[model samples]
Target: MRFTSCCGGAGAKTLVLVGKAGNGKSATGNTIIGRRVFESKRSLAGVTSTCQLETATLSNGQIINVIDTPGLFDSSVEPRLLATEIAQCIKMAKDGIHGVLLVLSIGNRFSEEEASAFASLCQIFGHEIADYMIVVFAHGDLLEDNQCLEDFWGPNCPQLLTDIMAMCGKRAVVFDNMTKDEDKISRQRKELLSLVEAVVKNNGGKSYVNYLFEALNMSEMDLIDQTSEVTCSEKSHEGKKFHIKYEEQFEQLIKMVELRLGECIMRLEKQLAEERVARLEVELKAQAAQTKSKEEMIEMKERLERAEELSKKLEEKFKNAENQSKEKASETIWSRMGCIIM
Candidate 1:
C-alpha cells in the first residue's frame, strides 16, 4: 500500500482531494505532488472542468497520488455528471485510498451547494470513508492574526460543516498552497502525510473501503470478500472446536432416543405375543368341545339301535298269543254241531 517509486524510491501514499470549485483544489494537489501537474487557474467557468489525476514525490520523499476533482461539489456541474467524475477518480485509486482530504477554503463562506457534497460523498463512497478522513483548510494564507483553524471554523462555522468534520475523527489541517516559502510548504505536507499515517496505523495498516465502492469497481469488493473470508475462517475454526466439544453429548442424546424406541418395540412385541397365546388357548378349547360332541353323537346312535331290537321282540310275543286263542274257538264250534245231529 506504499509507493516507493516516486521521489527517488520513497514509500507511497494515495490521496484523493474533494471540495467545491475555485477552493484551490488543484493548487493543493500541486503542493502535495510537488509539481504543477494540475491546471490551477481562476475563471468564471472554474478550472479543471473534469476530474484530473497525477502522482509526484513530495519534498518529504514520499510519493503521493492526487486525484483533483473539478466542480465535484460545486453547483455549476450537474449532479449526475459529478457522480460520474467522482467514480472515475475512485477508479484511478484502485491501489487503495489512504486519505480523503475534504478541501475547504480558509475564509470563504461555505455555500449550500458545497455543504451538500458531504452527503454526496457518503452516497458515492460509503460511511466508513469519514472515519480516517482529514479536513484540509485550503487557502490557509488568509488566516488573520490570532485566528487559527479551529477558532475560525468552530465558533461561527455552519453546523453542517462542523458535523462533517466530526465524521473525520475530528481531524483537520491547514494548507498554504499559495505560499512560495519552500520550508513552510514542506512542513505542511509533512504534517499532512504524518496525520494520514496515523489514521492508517489506527486502522491496522488497512485502507478505509466504502461498501458502495465495491459496486463502483470490482477490485474493492474482491478485497472485502477476501478479508471477510479470512474473518469467517477464523470464526469458523472456533465454531468447529465448539462443535467437537459437544459431539459426545449429541451422540448420547441419539443413543437415548434409540434405547427408548427399542423399549417401545419390545413392549409391543410382548403384547402381540400375549395375544397370540390367548388366541391359541381359545382355539384349543374349541377343538376339545368339538371332540366331545362327536363322541356323544356316536353313543346316541348305538342307543337308538338297541331300542329298535327290543321293540321287535315284544311285537312277536303278542302275535303268538292271539293265534292260540283263534284255534280254541274253532274246536268249540265243531263239537256243538255233532251233538245236534245225534
Candidate 2:
C-alpha cells in the first residue's frame, strides 16, 4: 500500500468505505484512490450495480482495494443475502483493512437501513470495529440548510446519530463529494496513519485504550453526578476539571492506539471464526458421506452371508440325489444276478 505520509507503521492499513446504497461510497472511493476504480452510474432505481472487487493504487503507494457492493438495505433484496455479501467482503479484505468509513449523506437523515448496516458491522467485526470507524458524512454542503453539520448533529439530534458517534468513539468528519473535497480525506488518512503507528508501538493499544477511556468517561460522569456538594470545593472543582482534561488527552492517545490494536485483533478473530465455521461444515459433510458408505458396506456383508448359506444348501441336496441314484443301481444289479442264478 502506498502511504505518502509516512508514520513508519508496522503493517499496511486497509480503509473500507461502507454505507447504504446510493450513498456515494464508490465515488468517494474513486476520489480517494484518485481515479474511478469502481463503476458509478445513475440508474432508474437507487442501486450501485458493481458487486465485484475493484482495486487501485494511490499516488502514496497504498494498495486500495475498493469493494463495490450491492446496496446494504434494498427493500427488494433479502437482508440475510446482503449481509452475506458484506461478510464475503470482510473476509476478502481481512488481510489489511484497518479503517472503516461509514459514509452517510449529509442531506439525508440516518435511516433504519443505516442502523442495520451499523448492526452488521458490529455483528461481523464485533462492537470494536466501531472504534476504527469514521462517520464520513457525504455531500457536506447540503447541510447549509442546517447552518452547520456540527450544529445539526449537535446536542439535540436524534439518538441514532448520537449512538453512532458514541459507538464510533465520536470520531467523524464531513466530506462534500459534490464539491470534490480532499481535506477530510487527508485528515482521515492521517488519523489512520497515527493509528497504525500506535498499533505498532503496542499491539493491544487500540482495545486497551478504548477500555481505559470508557472507564475514564464513566468516572468523569460519576464525578459530576455522584459527588456530595460538601465534599467538593471551588478550587478542587477547577483542579478536577484540569485533571480531567489532561487525563482525557493522555487517554485519547492511548485510546487511539488501543483502537487500532483492537481492529487488528478483531479482524484476525473474525477471519479465524469464519475459517473455523467453514472447516467444521466441510467436516460435517464428509462425516455424513462416510456414515453412508459404512451403512452400504454393512448391507453388502449381510447379502454375501445369505448367498453363502444358499450355496451350501444346494450342494447338500445335489450330494443326496447322487447317493440315491448309486444305491438304486446297486439294488437293480443284485436283483438281475438272483434272476440269472435261478
Superposed model 2: Cα runs more than 4 Å off: 1-11, 41-45, 73-75, 145-148, 180-342
Residue lDDT tens for model 2, 1-342: 111122234334556677877777776666656666776653324456535566655556665555566675454665445545554454445343456678877667788557755775565455756656767777666666536666766776768778887887676666555554476667644554455344334434222122333443455565555444435466577667766764665455445434544454455557668979999999999999999999999999999999899888899988999999999999999999999999
Positional deviation of residue 219's Cα in model 2 after best superposition, in angstroms: 45
**10 residues in a row with least lDDT, candidate 1:** 1-10
- C-alpha root-mean-square deviation, each candidate: 36.4, 20.0
List of clashing residue pairs for candidate 1: 3-12, 4-10
Kindly list the per-residue Cα lDDT of model 1 for residues 161-191, writing each as its tens digit: 8788778887888998878998988888888
In lDDT terms, which candidate is top? 1
Residue-level lDDT for 327 in candidate 1:
76
**lDDT value for candidate 2?**
0.60
lDDT of 2 at 89: 56
Count of residue pairs whose backbone atoms collide, per candidate:
2, 13
